[model samples]
Target: MQSKKIAIIGAGVMGKKHAQTIVKHPDTELVAICDPFSDAMAQEFNVPNYKDLDDLLNTMTLDGVVIANPNRFHVSTAIQCMQHGVTCLLEKPLALNTAEALTLIEAQQSLNVPILVGHHRRHNKIIQQAKEIIDAGTLGEINTFNALWSVYKPDSYFDIEWHRVAGAGVLAINLVHDLDLMRYLNGEIESVQAMTSNKNRKLEVEDSISILVRFKNGALGTLLASDAAVSPWGWDQNTEENKTSFAVSPDQDCYFISGFEGALSVPNLEYWNYPKDQSKSWSTSLMKNKVEPNKEEDVYIRQLTHFVDVMNGIAEPISSPQDAIHNIQLLECIELAAKEQRTVYLEQLQCFKKSA
Candidate 1:
């Protein structure tokens, strides 16, 4: 079987993960990894590596590229890869801002190539089952949803240069995932009222953010994210008392969703379809399929595999550059609402208005 050649930009933690995925996947070969900090990640993955995007592009014959660089570098790297006719699976938030993300999207449309965004949460088995339940109308009308995402960023994390960027902190890096998930499950966000602060962390970007969002379908979604907790991870009943940190237990990482008819939780993507009085409330369940808990394989592998598949004409790309643009537009709304202490209307995302 012929394998597709792939290049991963940014030899950061995430970049190395994508490289490992490419090397392991049966359908792809990791041609090279590019990053200015290649030395920092030199031994992280076994692959042909480089220190610059241009070097990798010039040196290798590649079918796709993975943009796992800093948030600010996403647009330029994606544009470069796509302009060369290479499919890209870009890391989330799309870009540092909506305008840049939209520009890339327009360019992507002209190129007519698949550009998939790295929103791995969208591929979680539990989340997939929840979406199926919602579409099946087993949940009835979705009235309310709450997404809580919080973690303590350690002092070491602050040492990174990009971590200090104005728009690269928790809001764009962390909450963007939940925000995208909300849109994935419920629908478009129509408006948002938000609040954010950096009271605890002495950083350029806000460490904590909370937003009240109204979905177009009238579903109320409340999303929260923070990196200000004393311990990054919360107290666990099973662990020793001293085990208080940002390290999340696999069991605890699960999310849940509730509706008029039933509720669905991680590990148990089950649904109680019947009402209180109707035939004992029918219950259907799906057991969690535990794949190897390797971060590289679970998230980055599926992401790269999806990208290679699209490039090879095996599967259609699921997340388009337009999706990334829309997600970034939503992130922009959240940022503005939080900064100004006002409700940001979805229509106000004209900053990402399609260019003529």
Candidate 2:
């Protein structure tokens, strides 16, 4: 098969990562780059850089474009690419808010162009294995989930003005990834109750938050996140997916899920259940087993391969725009819950007004 030609938009950290992965992948070719601010990444990768999306689109015949631009430009860029009939691997937070996301959702529904939202964790072998295990009924009738994402970012990391602002807080910046994975692994969230605090950093944005969620299936979940605490109990810390950005906590587990038949811990994939021969009671000890995931592959590479499949019509997007919109709605519900000091149902959000 001929290599698929791919272009990257935005020359930031994520764009550079995608460029590197594309260059290395045997099935992909790095064609061009579009970024208004910087051409440094384009120069490093030895690709022609254009300052505008239209210029790049008109010049190059691209099979797919990786939209790794800033959060604000996500929806517009994706729409532009789809209008040109190019597939996209759009970075997450598909839009600034649920309302903005709805616009993209509508464009996608009308255009019928494939867009793979970059909820990249879904490509991790560990997560894939966990999904299979759960789907196989290994953990029968999931009842609850407990997840943690607490890590103390260095004080200097917040020196950037935006880091201290409302839109760049831990909930939006960090916890969104965890929440996406929760919804991916568990199920759709029905409602949420949440609390946020910024006392640790005294910034305009919250540094810590606690959320309670009720899944549509009646399974409950709790997520505790803090960017101001010193802890090694987050997906980034436990998984080596982004070691350059986060220190690894080799022996820790970040998610604990339980059900009537068994309980499971994430990353480590430890399984706990009573042996069939033994009596199902508190008096008997539960058997412990390790569920091994497939050999590790770089998640970004996996995501790109999947994007290629999506572009070729061989596979549907694992994280479609419609699916990602729910994640945005979930975040909005949490924000409303925290702001109003009350439980917020996912259906209450205005983004759901049309669908509901």
Candidate 3:
């Protein structure tokens, strides 16, 4: 397959990573870097750097574009790209809120091209393996999950002005990942109630949040995240998938899931089931086992490959525009629930009402 040309829309951490991987992936070629403050990466990659989208669009036709820009720009940029017949790989927290995300999701309906959301964890081989194990009935009617994301950020990390705003909290940055992972591994979340606080640090945004989730299949879950914690539990702390993030020693587990047949832990891939010949009871001992994922390429590279296929009509997006929008709605509902101190059901949201 010929390499499809692509451009990075943000020059920050994620955009740099995307640019590096795009240039290296067999199916993708780095066309240019597009950011207002981006001469550095452009000089480094030897590609033209445009301060705005119109200039880049006028210059050349791209097979696709990656929107790694700020939270507020996501919907507008993606809508612009899609309107101009360019597919996009939009980063997570699809829009600033459910309302904006729903508008973009609506706009996508008029287009046939793909819009793959950057829920990169879904692309992981280990996550795929876990999905298979749960589907195989080995876990036997899985019903609950205990999700955690607890890590510490230094005082200096909040120096960025937006980092102290309403949309830049742990709820937006970290919990979004855990919410998507839970939906991908478990099922659709039907309702949510949450509480969040900036108790750990005096900031405009929350430093921690705890959530209760109810799935469409009747499964329940607890999703919690805190940037003020001193210990490790999140995927960043438990795995080495991204060496840029902190990885814990001895690899602590971040998820503990249970089903009728047994229990399981994520990343570690540990499974516990009752003895085959023994009567299942509180007194019976459970057998321990482990699952190893099939070797695969890096997830981000795989996501790019998937996007290449998605753009070329070889495959559908793993996280479609609608999927991205739903995650945002989930986050919105969680925030609303936290603020109002009440449970929020998915179906009652205006987005859902529009869909129905």
Candidate 4:
């Protein structure tokens, strides 16, 4: 088959990364890049660049478009691409909230083109193998998942102009990944009770949040993230304020999924394949099986490849726009649950609208 041509929207960090991979991958070619910025960096990449989406859409013949624009711009960008008969691979959080994401979902399904969201962690080899083990009933009756995401935030990160938006906080940018993963691992979250605080941070949004989740299957989950943690990674911790230092260690961002019979841990993808003997509880003799953890495969490359494959009728996309809507609804629940300090059901999530 002839190589597929791809257009990348947004020339920011993610756009550049996708462009690099598109050029490097043998299956696709980087035909054009679209961005409103006039930075010289756009030309440094050496592909055709456009000032806006229409200019690129009117001129280029693209098989697919990867949107790496800001959260607020995702829906509009995706709708335009789909209307033009181009399959799209959208970056995470899908959109600012559920309502916008739902609109795009409708558009894509009606257009008869594939729309793949960039939930890259789902593409990890270890994650895939773990899903297979769970599906195979090796870890019977999943009971709970404990996902903790904590990292130091740069001061400049909070200072970004768009950080003022309601959907720009830890819930959307960080915890959404964990929420989507948990939903992917188990099932829909049935109810949520959450709390959030601004604490020493100088931002309009909460710097720390803790969510209590009850899944439809009675599995319990806690999604917690704080910008106030002193870790040096990516959270909002600063040393001068507290004069206490925190180190980025080996186990930060690690997650685990536990079942009635066994459990699986991340980075290691260690599976406690419970022994087959039913008489004796396998907890004590839990045999450990280590699968090769999915390395840092260029997830954007894999996502783009999948989009092209789905367009060509060779493969089906795993993360559809419908999945994005569900994830966004979950996010809406998290925010509402946090604000009201009360349990919110999945069906009770309110549709979010754009700010005036």
Give me the candidate number with maximum lDDT. 2
List candidate 2 segments past 4 Å from native: none
TM-score, one value per model:
0.81, 0.98, 0.95, 0.87
Question: Best to worst by lDDT, what's the order?
Answer: 2, 3, 4, 1
Cα RMSD for candidates in order: 5.2, 1.1, 1.8, 5.2
Q: Write the per-residue lDDT of candidate 2 for residues 275-327, one digit (tens) a residue.
A: 99987788889999987755378998899889989988999999998888888
Predicted candidate 3 versus true structure: per-residue lDDT over 1-356, tens digit per residue: 68899988988889989998998888789988899965898899999999989889878899999999987799899988888899999988678776787788788887665799999999988888889889898889878999988889989999999899887888877788888989998888999999988988878899988999999989999988899997768887676676665756435778889999989898888999998898889899899999864434598988888898899988989998787777878887998899999999999987777753
Model 1 lDDT tens row, 334-353? 77887788998878656744
Candidate 4 lDDT score at position 321: 77
The candidate with the higher TM-score, 1 or 3, is 3
Off by over 4 Å in 3: 293-296
Q: Please give the CA lDDT of all the candidate structures.
A: 0.69, 0.90, 0.86, 0.74
Q: Score candidate 2 by lDDT.
A: 0.90
Clashes of each: 5, 0, 0, 5
User: Per-residue alpha-carbon lDDT of model 4 for 1-356, expressed as tens digits?
Assistant: 88888888888877887888788888898887788876454577677788878889989888888899887899989998888998888887687767777778778768887888888767655567778878887768988787766766778876777675565678877777778878887887788889987876756777888888999899998777786675433211211111234443433225678887778876456778656764446345678887765555655567666777886888877887777677888778878787777888876545532210
Error of 1 at 247 (Å): 2.7
| C-alpha lDDT (0 to 100) for residue 205 of candidate 4 | 79
Candidate 3 lDDT (Cα, 0 to 1): 0.86
